[model samples]
Target: MSERKKQHFINSVMSYITLSLATIIGITLISIFISFWVTELADKDAQAINLSGSMRMQTYYIGLVLERENVEAAQQAIEKLQNTWNSPLFAQQHALLQEPKQQHNLLTRHFGIAYTNWLHHTKPILMAMAKGQHKRSEIEFLLENQVLLTDALVTQFQNDAERKIVNLRTFQLLVLLITVSVGSLVFYLLKNRIERPLSQLTETAEKIGAGDFSQRVDVGGTDELTLLANTFNRMSESIANSYSKLEERVDERTRALKQHNIVLDFLFQTARNILESPNGQFDFQTTVENLSKVLGDHKLELCLFTERGEKPYLQLVSHNKAFAHCEQTNCSECRNQDSSMQALLLSRKTGFPITIGERHFGIIDLQLNNEQELPEWQHALVQSVANQFAIALSMSEQKDKENRFVMLSERTVIARELHDSLAQALSYLQIQVTRLQKSHDKQKYELQQPIIDELREGLSSAYRQLRELLTTFRLKMDEGGLQAALENTVAQLRERSNISIQLDYKLKNVPLAASEEIHLLQIVREAGQNAIHHSKGRNVLIELIQTSDNKVQLAVEDDGIGIPQTPEKFNHYGLAIMNERSRNLGGAIEVQPRSGGGTRISFTFMPSITRQPIA
Candidate 1:
């Protein structure tokens, strides 16, 4: 899921959780409050109604004093009290008061047994209380039952009320304890299972945002909160894991891209050189050879394919002696055709094309000895190289056209100079010779000989200058072959300077395009020049190493004056140019101070001798 969606879901879940918890708490509070209110009401109702039995007894006492037929009336009042006591109102009152005092002496003895029986036998008491109605013993009996029973019942009621108050207080205490326990439990549960974990999750998220993906949260329960915690922990873990992986991948990709850029830059510079040269011709064979030497054992097979209608064909081109040839194949999947050529043709989708505007020049294709699919990034690098090739080719073509015009202009100037100076001088000399012949004199002959000698000398100088120019041109063309170019450069360097030079070179046998070869030569020449001009020591070491990316590297190191100590001093034009050249070739130049007091200029290029797709 998208991060936004995931965040929204998490937020929604938290909102719901908050609402649910709020509802549960609200319900619990309301329930407790209702219970408290109901208890209070029941307590008040019990106190109010408990006076009924006492009031009825008082009335019966009055009836007895009047000596009327009040026994039945007292009995009726007693019956009314009993019925009232049997209902929920009296039951509520009794439950609140009776149970807790069951084991007590006053309540159990007087209230529970004696007082209740006297109330039931009130008819006899009232009758005895009537005037002239019974013997003294009976009257005494009546008064005993009436006074003692009423006194005991009243005392029982007071004691029961006090005990009920004590029980009610104890009940309130228990309720308070239960409420506290439940609240504490909820807080503890929330803390361990939800709160703490959520806090950790927030911390983890912050850490992740800060580019640290190493935080984790603990899971403590199987409730919804626990499930949420587990999910959050997993999400954090995933983020950390993915972030870590992403960093590593980015780092790896950056390095690879840098390397690829180096190769591309090299190719670009090489192509540019080939294009900008006075002559438009370039040597691909040498370039391929140098690339192979630099790349090592993963063989490079260079092919030139001309756009044959809508398709491309493999035209084998190589410089190394170990290289094989491809013939008459259209596709790699064509079993009946040359497998290598067929493979080359079939692998066009993997190959990057060189194009300029509406023009399609060609393609540079490389296949690694490995079977793994090229990573997308590497494929992109390949395409970038192809694009550079197209630009380079276009620039070279334009440069070639411009060079032609320049050449024509130079040729015209030279011809005019020869005509206006040398030709006229020769013509004048011829005329002078004719005059001397006619005169037939010794002085004239001597003058004619001097004139002829001067003319010959001038002509010879012109010829020599032209030959030198041709020689220079040949050298430039030969420089496209990496090995030839390196040899030629070393030879020239050795002849020009007193520095001793060593070259170690190895590469695949494939032929590279002319543009590729020329850049390699420039790289070699730059290294040699830097060594000669900057390094104050004698010996200079140059090595060409190839890597898996179908690229070649030229490293020059010398036991001489190292790179400047300060950053400003390090910004010398030569070093800057060298670095730029390396970058243009899609490579890097590291000018490190040698451990033993020299400068090492190492250039690393990608798509190295063995080209592989990025993974």
Candidate 2:
């Protein structure tokens, strides 16, 4: 197709408006020129008529003067009449009337006859009368003829002026009619070509802007508006096509996002179930059931290998059924030889290994139907779930190991305490018994009493130490932690004595490990016991506080007879035990006499939480 010529709408409208203005201006200018010409001619005609009337009056004046025999006045009137008749204003009017082809015209002829009578007959006759050589009848005849001709000329001048005015009026009316016709034509053209098309284009554009892309302008013309309409239609089509494609893409993205959200929700819920399980335990059966639901039609099973890694000892199925291969006897042969288990092995299935680095725990097996397959994303999801299960299992196993280790460690500590306190006391009693036996054989009854009393004291001491050990072993940190334990110990000791004991505990915000707290509590109890037994003071103060260096400081003070400078080690087993406990806490103990009267026991140690590990 031949390309459509480009036509700007602005230029076209300007051309029409400019043409209309030019036509109106031309008509107005012509009318102005004609009106000016007609007005000027009318003024000249009026002047001519005035001059003619003066000439007629002068003719009559000359007649009167002649009748009275006044030659001077008659001569003067004749001169004035000639002057009026020959004035340039009348001459011009006369010249205008003397058209060669219009010689028979009434106004022209009348003017000529009137002028001829004035120049030839009237003037000479009047001159004759002025010289007093004239007849009354003859002068009257000439004057009468002159008056009649002048009146005829005057009448023609009036008629000519009136005719011109009528013609001007008619011409002005025609010009007005032409102007109205042209203006109406221009207005019609502008409304049809420019205004209507533009309105259509504007309305169509608004519709398109309002999202109705199907709207199109059908302006029929070769102007710029028509071209705009075509271009607008094409643009709308393009936008519609693009919008459709965009909607399709949005739908596709929405579906994919929904799938991703489902996957993420499944993973989040599974992790939450694992974390919120009772006693930090992971529910594998619940996890497998959730996994089966997420996998749609796939059958899921979790098989765990034995401790020795020889074979699978436990299996959890998502269908909530007993292990199909198990006979409840935990026999390896039964599990390995079951036909159902063999069929599952040989069938179409996918496996995700439950593993962490080199340690393989088991396999998460998905039994797929015939000809079934998994997408890459689904495969990755299943693998991630298996990894989560492996992590839970690994954490559970690690926690068990730590508990066993802690148990063994506590047992070792108990054994050591037994050997140090109770065993030693018993050995001392055995020696005392041997001494008593020797005295009896030697017939030394007096020696027997001292030995017997010594044995009894030894046994009592042994019994006391044993009870203390038992109390230490039985000590467990309750909800109130070490502070509550300390309070209970002080309360028990208070019941046994009248000594007022005050516990000044100030380490409220300090973080302490369980082992550290246990040792600290034992040391405090042992020190309190020693204070009650040996200090014999009226008041005992036990203070526990944190120092500026972030170390814990424990002080036990009394106002009683102070410890001897050379105290026997065998008598101060409590001091030895306190020293041992402080050493275990990685701290130091000080035994010093109070400045007034009693002794003070001070123990300072770095809190386990604040202590850094050795390189």
Clashes of each: 41, 0
Cα lDDT of model 2 by residue, 1-615, tens digit: 234333464446667788898999999999999999999878778777787788877788888888888888888888888888778886654785666746557777887788887788778877876785666678777878888888888898889889999999999999999999999989997898788988888898888889888887788857666777788889989998999999999999998898888889989987887677665577787778877777775677677765554456567877765443333444243224234554454343366667888766776767665746776777888899989887877877887898999899888878877878888888899899899889999999988988888888998888988877887788878989999999998998898789999999999999898888888888888788888888889999999999999989999999989888775462466677778789988877798898898988899988877877877
The runs of at least 3 residues in candidate 1 whose Cα sits more than 4 Å from the true structure, single-residue gaps closed, are: 1-145, 214-615
RMSD of each: 21.6, 7.3
Candidate 2 local distance difference test against the native:
0.79
Candidate 2, residue 557: CA error in Å?
Answer: 6.4
For each candidate, give its TM-score against the true structure. Answer: 0.32, 0.66
Global lDDT of model 1: 0.59
lDDT of 1 by residue, 1-615 (tens): 477566555645345556556756765676577667656754654453355455445545545643444556655654555554455544544554466665455544554454355455644454454433554345445545555665665566666666766666766676567667656666666666567767877887787788765666665544555566667778877887887899999999998788777667656756665666555455555555545443332344444334343233434333332232232343322322334544564474444445667676655455545745655655565566456556655666788787888589557644644454445546655765566565466555556666566656656745643543343335565434667677777898898689999988876554555555655666666567767766788999888876555567667889997877763354243455456557756877777887898888778765333454567
* Leading candidate by TM-score: 2
lDDT score of residue 429 within candidate 1: 58
Tell me the TM-score of model 2. Answer: 0.66
Q: Show where candidate 2 strays beyond 4 Å.
A: 5-252, 278-281, 320-349, 434-444, 478-615
